[model samples]
Target: MGLSNWPDICLGSLTPLLPEDFPIDEDHEFKPDNFYFLKGCVHFKNTAQILDMTNKVKKSRWRDFSQSFLRDVDNAAKKADEEQEKPKYEIKSCGEMMRTIKTMVDGQKGEKICELSMTFVSFDSSMVRFPDKEHSRHPLEICPVEAGSENKHECFVRHSIPYFWDMSSQFGTLYKCLNQKRVKIASICAFGFGKDAVLAIEGDQLDDVCALSTCIILLNGRDAMDH
Candidate 1:
């Protein structure tokens, strides 16, 4: 927020006080911003003070609104950290996961193609990160049991992989109250591939490895907002 007095919230800064609430998803992410996030995470250090302040403010209260937004930000950051922990050998994208998979699929190394099955554990969204502000990051943990797990193996099962995404990347510009940039195609596409699980096998090995990927290409938050 422009107001300096308000708390700063980021999407990647929380040090989890407990094990993540959601598990992994079809793609193996640590969804932390889900409703179950707070259920699984230890309360913020200043719980009493946070609650007291929340109670004092009304919906119209800018401080309250900003506070609530910051709390969500903190939660989103924590959730993002949780999502970043796991990786599926089949999944591919930029640097980390991409490199890990590269190590696995580059047949020159002759890695074993073991049967891999992932259950839908959790999937959630981290809040938008604005360049102008050095807000603290937090993640929101989402359990697959609650909604779409965004996985093929554990889409419904409790053992699925987890997935995390930055809301700012997907919907930064459209979120007016946040006053961020417009829908960023590059960031959105990066996240699109990021949450995706790519199964790369040596030539003619497709039949040997029976794997699938599922990521619904739904519109950004604005789509949800319109409805």
Candidate 2:
């Protein structure tokens, strides 16, 4: 569909993912809910420094012997180390069929957040798994929904079995099955094509895992179509 129509679809289909017990501000009527916008292509860099003892020893002889010179080098090295140590998300390809998404837990330690694997029988369908969950082995299926013949923008999000089967008639409503309960989590609307595209996610259900998963799925789908 056109980019202009997505906001209405998103807002209309939006449902609270949070539990009823979650605290809410009764007096703040004007405050807008927080949301995240993701680009089609994301780039991440690690600035960790590698200290060379040989270079340090050689430079020590010719470089300034003052304490100020030593302090400057120490600070630069420390800054670089800190930047590298910070936890961030990463995506890695596992052969041809599987792509894994992970995040840095403690310095240099990696934890699997989720995995997206293409189905052998149906190229259009893919499965996602959360390794940390109790039922990590069970994979959730995700597929693209057709949005009119003229509209090129594709919308893909996780849905319950009933919702998936009844999508044609119930396209306006979306639900996510979590822990055997149907919950309305997040809605992701992607605009444009390929690397230039952008993704807008509903504020209420937005989280690191949800945002990253949606971005990976959409980008991968685009790449598959290109081939």
Global lDDT of each candidate: 0.21, 0.34
lDDT of 2 by residue, 1-227 (tens): 11222121121133412222122223323211222223223321111111222222223322212344344334544554566533244454443433323222222345556665543222245556676643222344554444233322223333222112112221112333333333443333332242322222234443445444544554444334324
Encode model 1's per-residue lDDT on 66-132: one tens digit a residue.
Answer: 4464455345434545765221222211222211111112122333332112222123321221122
Please give the clash total of every predicted structure, in order.
48, 0
Worst-scoring 10-residue span by lDDT in model 2: 44-53
Which parts of model 1 are misplaced by more than 4 Å? 1-106, 118-145, 148-227
Q: Measured by C-alpha RMSD in angstroms, how accurate is candidate 1?
A: 22.3
